[model samples]
Target chain A: MREGTGLPAVDLGTTEMLEPGTALLIPTETSGYQEDIGLFRAETGSYYALDDECPHEVASLSEGWIEGEEIECPLHSSRFCLPDGRVLCLPAVRDARTHRIEVREDRVLLYPGTAATRT
Target chain B: MSIESILVIGGGLAGFTVAQNLRARGYAGALSIIDPAGIPYDRPPLSKAYLLGQKDTAGIALAPAEWYAEHRVELIRGTVRKLDTEYLGVELADGRRVHADRLVLATGGSPRPLPIPGGDLETVLALRNKEDADVLREKTTPGMRLVIVGAGLIGAEVASSARTLGAEVTLIDPVDPPLVPAVGQALARRLHAMHLDAGITLVHGTPVDISKTTHGHSLILDDGRSIDCDEVLVGIGIVPNTALAQAAGLETENGMLVDENQRTSNPLIYAVGDMARTRNPDGSLERRGEHWEYAMNTGATAAAAILEQELPVHGASWFWSDRHGTHVEGVGDMNGVGATVLRLAGEDPIAAFHLAEDGRMLGAASIDGGLTIRAARRIIDRGIIVPPESLADPGIALKKLAR
Candidate 1:
């Protein structure tokens, strides 16, 4: 898992607020989304969040394109499968660090690190 | 008989892909691989991290030793001296003959040697396998004057790696605007500039002579310019190992000729990777594709054909090269395709999509925009027609146009 700032989980937005094939960029500091975490809404209505930085290069996943259950990095086009964050292509030999995301009512909450357990 | 036993000659990616994909597709046959190298490792990193001392040889193995044993795949470390197609067996250098129901040739290729004066000097080197890379790595020290005699992917990558190590690099090639044939004039110009900006001396000329100098060596170019250096690294190209195939009476041209199914002249024998020249869909012999993806795809194609399984639809040809810390990729047949459209303007992650006359996407190339090339690859494979305006727009998701 990537070394996070160890910040507490934050309430992102509503389930309806993020449509399928949409990704929201969240930064570590509230200065402006320079890309810290990428919260993605898969076409299958599943929500996945991962480190915004691509493991292959320094591309932000928030600026990448959503392809079904995978996210293609805009910079190097490395594909990471959702939920597990396992790399599905070359250039990126390692998997991306996936974060836990849960929907409470219409709000989406994100927990950093490898623990994807529900509280 | 349903291939009860198989013998794969080579431990490279192509050999591994065939063995693994066959097993994944439920091949319960007796499998064995005869590789000159003891372990099956990746070759791409030889010019990058592996050469820079950032990664060790063990880290490059495709799979752990336990994985092969667990999968019941026999790995034999020996060189195949000849292919006995008469009995579908291979003659090993140790006078051992291994017979199999199906035989696959994944012999791969070797670096083409420079045929100039003083080309065989001890300091002159070419990288192909791990052993070659190890020697190159030892020579790449700070202040080492390196003269590279090609601007192709391998040469360029070596130059980048050498430069990163604080070595003085002079890259020379006969072609003007390096990589223009593959990535087009505009992108090649950007790459040429990048090489120059990184303090590498890029010379557009062919080497006519290589002689020993007091410092190390001196390479005289066709344009009469001379470069004095500590070592000469030649990365011109590769020549496929076809002697074994030819000895077995297999058809050979650019490489061991194979049908679309990866079947050689003999129905029981197949060839893949840099050694196999496949027949195109149009019934013409394809110039062998030596990239990693082509090797993997051909391996898979051979496995599916052997298993009598439904062949997966072949996608657009794809390849990636990393130099100067940027990943550059090209997908599909850029040369055989129609006009090209620049998706992103300016520098850095520039992308271009080649479209047929009827507006169908045929291929794509990108600097750091692998995602764009990924999307365009599907468009090419599926014969998707996308409006030029939509493709030019960065906001528009290229994958959405697939449907």
Candidate 2:
């Protein structure tokens, strides 16, 4: 059973959450687009979720490496700032879609319908 | 002194970026870009996506047409015949002299011509602008025999696209390994193998002459072999458009001389992009950078300099090319910079990092490993020291080393 904190939530299994500095690619449906979402756990315990696809080549961003607040796509050096999903480098011209995330009762919950929370 | 009016001579990526960045930086001055091309679009896709019909012309626009009007940046489609340095203006071919308080030169570069007889034949072509690309798209057909004169990024990608379009491509270069100087030996070998796997004919020979035939042209090689093709694309290199700078009495050698701040001999005038040979931050001479990132970087630096703001520091020089459906990006000094090469671990895709003796990352080249190269950029920029064993490990996230 999953508990929703006033938003649509998808239970990612309590013990299966990725560690900090790592990301997980979880398929989810958004209001505008339906695709896999990349959920990242920062070193500070905060969570961020963005579209899994890199806009430049449509490569999976879940395989990307995350720095302070940026995600570098694995296929090409296209980078984007987290939370707001602002483009930080070239080869990728569009911004990734950032979704809302929350940890509800030891389980990772992703709210895909919420508006993007800008950093 | 305030810059009330700014005129950018060139409407390519460099020119377009400067205009947009100036406005983004809150400059209320009148900005105008003058160039021979009507619409300013990106050029990277001309050899890959656009040529292969994967991307259309509209996909390459830097900014929508309405963006210029909204930003109040005037876009003029015209060619400049002369640069009037005294009045800080440009003389157009139509006898119009447009003056500005400040002038920025972004006249990128022109394709180098093949030094051989019959090189300018109708069937022979070179891709530099949209017109050249359009001509190539028209001639790219199935069963067509295409011969490329160089094995640089442009020629290699063009071969990839031509192969995708069902054309038989033959790439001829004087060097044994074409991309060794740019991407090191290992990655260059991979690319060479990739091209061969895609059925592209690789020939190691210097082109001596081009003879026109009834069907097409025959390219004669110094090795006493002739390659017959329906079309010839000479992607040897580029020659910077420094004539305007030379005529304006600005110092010019390999290119128009400029400082790290993109400042030319005259403080009122500035030159950036492929046409400008920039000086290092410490006043050392640097050759002109032909990469698109260099154009954008110099454009932003010039805008910041005009606003009297602090100049941004450039990190590792980066460039990327697509071949045989694989995207390869090279960052920093791929000449190895006397550093040891370490291949990073990944199965689907791989990357090679160049680490200096002091444990500082010097450069990286990757196939489908753009993230590693992006992380490697910060390591090289910050001079971060990481153990070679750690860099080779797949478990260790390279970005964490930046801290």
Candidate 3:
């Protein structure tokens, strides 16, 4: 229901190609990869991308430990999921965002809202 | 019945703030608030400015009766006995039920009682809310012997406030060096000296053996020294009101377990204030914060989360007290910190800063105008490291703590 849910996609030509099991964090509008928290290979061999920066404090999820789909921030250790971006911890009441990615031929491009606005 | 209405229970500081914010933020659905205690009132001033007659109870209320009606906020009067999540409602004590789409548990907490004998019979008093202050105020007579248990922030402040009202006060606690629970033992001792200088008798490393009397009460010490007192005041600590959460099958630790958004086990429910102990980022359970600023900030944070809105990052934890006309404020925990910088603002003010090993502010203590403590609070939250020279120079107002 927020503004700019359906925006035109730009052609992200040739870049480093990641396998279906692995994810790459490319810069998105207003959002960043935050840290190098590689990616999660789902049961269906799908990759989910997320911002390693916690929505709560200055804690980085890349430095923190990961469990299943959830990555905990090392600073405050607030847990956020890579799939739907749901928060599962205290002191962090906001949810981190998951970028919609389009893997064409070999390049990976991140789209802000490939689906609905979860902001 | 399907609930499209939110019922905020307990019209204390937390409850009113939640309702006030929801309306301000454009929540147009049915909003209700519950309070058996009548209009929303403030308890912070009751212990300090109110007792000193600096401010009256009327000045402290968050909401008057008319404000609720103006906002179309349904203010209910009665005790909310049980909460049923499946039914999407709360059951009143009188067998009535209030329907709600969401629930906010803001019951607050009760004061910790003296662990001594005869504590049950009111030989001593514990203060957490406004009612406790009213009872203690009535009993405080001129030149009455008052043996206060616990020399922590509450105990010391109460002692200081009671002393101003003409009571011979003796503060009893087990802190060999006071303020040990907050700042380390060494720093607590330094502040303990301040209490002693204020003419308060500190019975450190010992507790009072309270006994009831025909007239009033008598505290028998371990050394066989009995101090006859008209009354006793306990400032040990507090316990959160978490029974409602536990009864509703919500997870609870020292208080109700809440996520960063202050959400309980159920997503439809949220808890805040003293009764809700949220886990820190380190996976440690942190509860029992009694500061007014912390309460207001945390309460606001929880309210925002419930609306699924982005909350401004939580600032550092803070505790403030006014003792014997002296203002004492602390930011962050100083026990794990080191290298306290002592500075004096002119000849009238004093400031002390506790720095973490990494040079970030761990905590700050100040006297006189409370400007430095306010500034230091912002600095600690942002993890700003002030230069040692800046800290040492009394010319530098702690306003530099705000990054």
Candidate 4:
């Protein structure tokens, strides 16, 4: 509920409305998703990670929003999985590197192995 | 010890530019930037392209990692809680304290929140930070109704983005044509056409009184008509984040009062961007300046202040908005513009300008004027006054002022 602009970060851990069994695929700051860096808040604590860059074309995955573990590219409807980096839709076939995460005190700390997530 | 290390508080355009220009100006020093827990990102697009899904945060990356390392700027990830002027340091929310020889409080402004009825939870949203945009984005369904409570630049940009996202947008404003506070009524009226043509419901001359309804809330207009809405967006104004500087005993008004050099009451600390209620040639202090370029230019001015270098005289303010496929620009302060002039590439595609009664031109807004905008900006920024005839003849360059 912050006035967060650009892909601002929303920690799923911060809200109670996020129910279990459903997953939230959030964008990390490493990807530079501007406003709410998509927060993946799974009530079950099960989450998925993917490159915010859409493998198809140049559309940023951060622009493309998340539905379940599948994130829809905002430009084209290129869908990809948060876990295991698989493309479920067309125009995007490359798998994005899964960002390593450690839930530190309910806050997700992203470990960029190469620290090369563009944004 | 000489001020060699700089800690810039706030990673918006100003903060980033201060760091960027420091490198560009050949000043090498230990640099650190503290923002609220996100990679440094550009914000102008949040109200437009980002909102329209045209771009994401990555698209507007100001500095990549290589740039940061090459420039030697450490990116501190959090909000600044307290600034110890005596210690020449800042305390971040994460409990990490950093010290610098000089501190630049670029802690821009926050969105002005409404304190009126129906302003409680489940009904309202503000577009300031990265999270707020996502909140609105998540809530906006294909047919979700959005009532935009203001018709200013940010509000209008959000309106355009919402409409593009397939949401039904209703912009309610008490002012006629909107943007009168920034751009005068004449230019505001012309821009109004662009909004209406983009499928937005424009309610003018009517103040909306928000009240709780069975479903979310309702904005009851002064005309006695009520519109049911899924959510309310108030972009009416902004509140400067002057508390940080104020807490440290720096002069503060509606914004942190600063001199033309961007030096605040304490010369040891400098303030830039909107947070600095900078003095004008007219002897008045500007509480706010909402342009991206102004932030960049002002940052450079503050850097000059830090270096004790001669600074450039203030130029005409320039700003742009890309909403609903239209790119509108204003050169010079639109606040003083009075007389109106409409230009056209052809008989159909048009743009407009405004000037005061004394023929002192004030503002300009163009729609797809292309490079013509480049020419117009030069004319306005350099104070080149063009005659009415040259405007009609597109062949002449906008710089021919004396003739």
Candidate 5:
């Protein structure tokens, strides 16, 4: 058994639901959190998670375009690095909050309220 | 010569971006921003979120006080009397002189006054800065009759926001549906029709005169129609503030003339933001960009030029406006001569794209289609030749074509 971080890990369905270079939103009710969570799969077949809300406005990051390891906010074009949620552009000075995601044998699991382990 | 200290006039987005980019690029020399407004805040929200009471003064600030202190950027609150180019310094209105090795002019534009009778009335309002928005917000009350002239971006946004505040808004414009040049005719028509749905009365006429009335004001139109309202807002456009540049012997034609690097006629001085117009190598002046993104882009370019670093490359021009609970974004040249392809969903225009004869995407505009616009920007930047059928088909996601 893997050592637990005390927080509940949510199975976000199968990895097949999220193809390479695509993203999906985990609603607040499903994530058991107040804010929605965005799970993105880069073209390199890596998974990263972040708060769905763009730090600049009320836009959902899940709807944003994903290029490489950065996600460009649909509104105002503010880009955030997927791994650490660092702001890569202007109009948004604050960095977004990132969450941890793990793909355990084709099953995607989300550790809500936990910081993403930097790769 | 190495730049030891830099001074920027006008603490708007352009000036703030210059300072911000300078620090980000590791230029640790002395930097300062001087403006009549003490702190730099965003202006786009002034006619929308800030006016609607959704955001406070602190919310619109470009950066917090701590950021300025941490970055060691001095924020000076003063008005510039004149530019002492010989000494590479500025003379404040209070008789104080601040010297710097390099000078940047980001003095943005001022609201263009209506050129008609009683147009300059004290009660006639214009939204440019925070104080203007605060005053407009205070006057915008429930059931108050408000008449806004010029249904452009700012006027339309204010009308929508005022209606949300329960005010009776009447918007006036010369054109049937304004902003055809910015967002194309189809998208502009869709956006303009939203005013009626939101309970804003649209008036297609020019105001010939504005007279003070007992109850409020009477705006006389060229068609001999008069609109009586408690308050009036004129948002036609802005006149670039080029007086300082003209007095300092810099090239000024409608705006301060600058090269591709944002450098003015005088090598020691540079200008950015709305006040600076690019003069091509052939001596033709390009249209001055007055949008927020253009200001930020020019500031970044100016910072790099000042530090002798490689200039940052910016893509096509982009702008966005919010009204009637809908977000409209457009990128590149929407007015280019080409065929227009519109993507509609159940009779509503979700996105409209312009394509050249060779199928190259020229420009695109969309309502509540942020993802579509983002993809369109990439397609335009990369010069992607997408078929018209795929662009018009709502079933086919634009993101796929962008790849």
Candidate 6:
């Protein structure tokens, strides 16, 4: 049993649906947040969650390409550091809001509204 | 030569980027940006979000007011009267002479005025900056009849935004379906078709004249057909602000001619963004790029060159436009010689990919397919050859092919 942070942890289902180096879009209803959450699994097997919307324009970050620990927004190519949601490029100066994510025993757990701090 | 102080003219994205990158690259020199508009704000949103009242002036600002103060960048509010190349500075229109060790010109461009009669009327509008957007926004009202001249990016965007604001928009253009060179014919057709669907009257004719009417304005097409509208907006294109560059004797054709490092004929001065046209080593002048990303890229290149640092590698030219609640993105040279492989979703064409004769990807354009365009940009940049079958298949993910 993983220690909970006292916040509501929504089980995003088995990691089978979210393979390594892929991203899964958790809808607003599932995340219980106003905006959708983007759940990304890096090739290194690290899971990170961020707001699905790109800060620049009306773009879904979940549809963006993932390279290493950065997610490049498909629209305008504004890249964000996956771990801390730091903006890595121009056209987008605002940092994206990141959510905490933990994967235990193939079960992906997402803490909605919890800030993902750089470990 | 030690560049102790740097002066940048124009406060658009290009000028702001040069100043921003200078600070980012740890050049703690006396940096100052002079512009008629004090702060640097984004222009792309001026046509869509800003005009539609979705984004405020602050929202479209390149950086907050505190950013300049924090970065020690002095923002000067004034226009440049003359470029003093000998003094390596500028004379402000207000008669203030400011000197710096290095001078950067990012003067950007002004809206291309209509050549017909009544085209230059004060009532006729054009959107290029925040002030222009504000005026357009104020004039746009429900049931207002608006006629936009030019069906290009800005014209089309204003048409879409005006329609959203409950205005009856009539978009007139010389070409039946414009922007074929930007996004290719297939995507251009689809994008132009959206105007009709959005209740905008698309006029396929050239405007010969604009005359004031009793109620509003009347635009006479080449065929003598007239369009009556409450407001007229001209979004044809832009004329580069090269007066300062020309007066200083820096090479200028369509725009200020700059070398690979963004250095003009005079090494002390540099030019970037829409007003700076790159001159190839073989003496061929590249077209001046007016896109937002191109401005930032040129700014970055100028900054690196100024700091004696390695220039940042830029990928294929990319641009995006939002209209009718749909996002369109294009990358690379879509007009190049290639076969277009279109990915369709049922009856709708979602993505179009241009593949070269040698199997390499030349360019791509998509409607509401940002990811597809992003992947195609990577493929084009990396010189990756993708199978046309896989590119056309909607089932196969574009990301997979990029890898």
Query: What is the lDDT of every predicted structure here?
Result: 0.83, 0.82, 0.69, 0.68, 0.91, 0.90
Model 5 bad stretches (over 4 Å): A1-6, A13-16, A103-107
Instruction: TM-score chain B for all models.
Output: 0.95, 0.96, 0.90, 0.90, 0.99, 0.99
Local accuracy of candidate 5 as per-residue lDDT tens digits, B1-403: 7778999999999999999999999999999999998989989989998998888988888988899999999999999989988989899999999999999999999999999999999889999999999999999999999999999999999999999999999999999889998888888999999999999999999999998899899999999999999999999999999898788888899999999999999998999999999999999889999999999999999999999899999988899998887999999888777889999998988899999888899999999986898889899999988999999999998999998
lDDT of 6 by residue, B1-403 (tens): 7889999999899999999999999999899999998889988899988888888988988988998999999999998999998888999989999999989999999999999899999999998988888999999999999999999999999999999999999998889789989887777888899999999998999998998988889988899898888999999999999998898888899999999999999998999999999999999989899999999999999999999999999999989998898889888887778788999899788888888899999889899885888889889999998989999899998988998
The candidate, 1 or 6, that scores higher on DockQ is 6
Q: Give the lowest summed-lDDT range of ten residues in model 3 chain B.
A: B343-352
Q: Best candidate per lDDT, number?
A: 5
Candidate 5's displacement at residue B1, Å, is 2.7
Task: Report lDDT (Cα) of residue B52, candidate 5.
Answer: 88
Error of 5 at B130 (Å): 0.2
Worst 10-residue lDDT window for candidate 4 chain B reads: B394-403
lDDT: worst 10-residue window of model 2 chain A:
A1-10
True contacts kept of 5: 0.62
Taking the tens digit of each residue's C-alpha lDDT, what string does model 3 give over B1-403?
4436888888877777788777766777898888887787767667765665665666556655687788989889999889898997899999999988898888888776656567666546887767778788888777887888888887887888888888788888775776755644444665667767777777854554677788788877767777777888877778788888899899998888887787888988988777877866677886556666556666788767767778957667766566765556666766663777767555432666788778988887665533566567668877777886797687665554453
| Candidate 2 per-residue lDDT over residues B165-230, each given as its tens digit | 999999998987888777777777778878899999999999999988889889889888988889
Ranking by DockQ: 6, 5, 2, 1, 4, 3
Please count the clashing residue pairs in each candidate, in the order shown.
1, 0, 4, 31, 0, 0
User: Number of the top candidate by DockQ?
Assistant: 6
Write the residue-wise lDDT of candidate 5 on A1-119 in tens digits: 22334258899888887788889999988988668999999877889999999988889999889998899998888999999999987778788888888889989889887888876
Give per-residue lDDT, candidate 2, residue A21.
70
Per-residue lDDT tens digits of candidate 4, residues B1-403? 6668988998887887788777667778788889884567677767865666666766656555676877788888887889888988999878888999888889888878665555545458889877788788888778888989888888898888898888999988887777655545555677778888988998874544677677666877767898888888988778889888888888888887788888877877888887877867687877567677678777888887787778867666766666666666666655552666666565543556666676656666565554445456556665666776666565653433322
Per-model C-alpha RMSD? 3.6, 3.8, 15.6, 16.4, 2.4, 2.6
Q: Residue by residue across A1-119, what tens digits does model 1's lDDT show?
A: 35545346677777887879878887767313234888899989889888889876568887788879899887656789878888876446568777888788878878765445434
Q: Could you tell me the TM-score of chain A in candidate 6?
A: 0.89
Higher-DockQ candidate among 2 and 3? 2
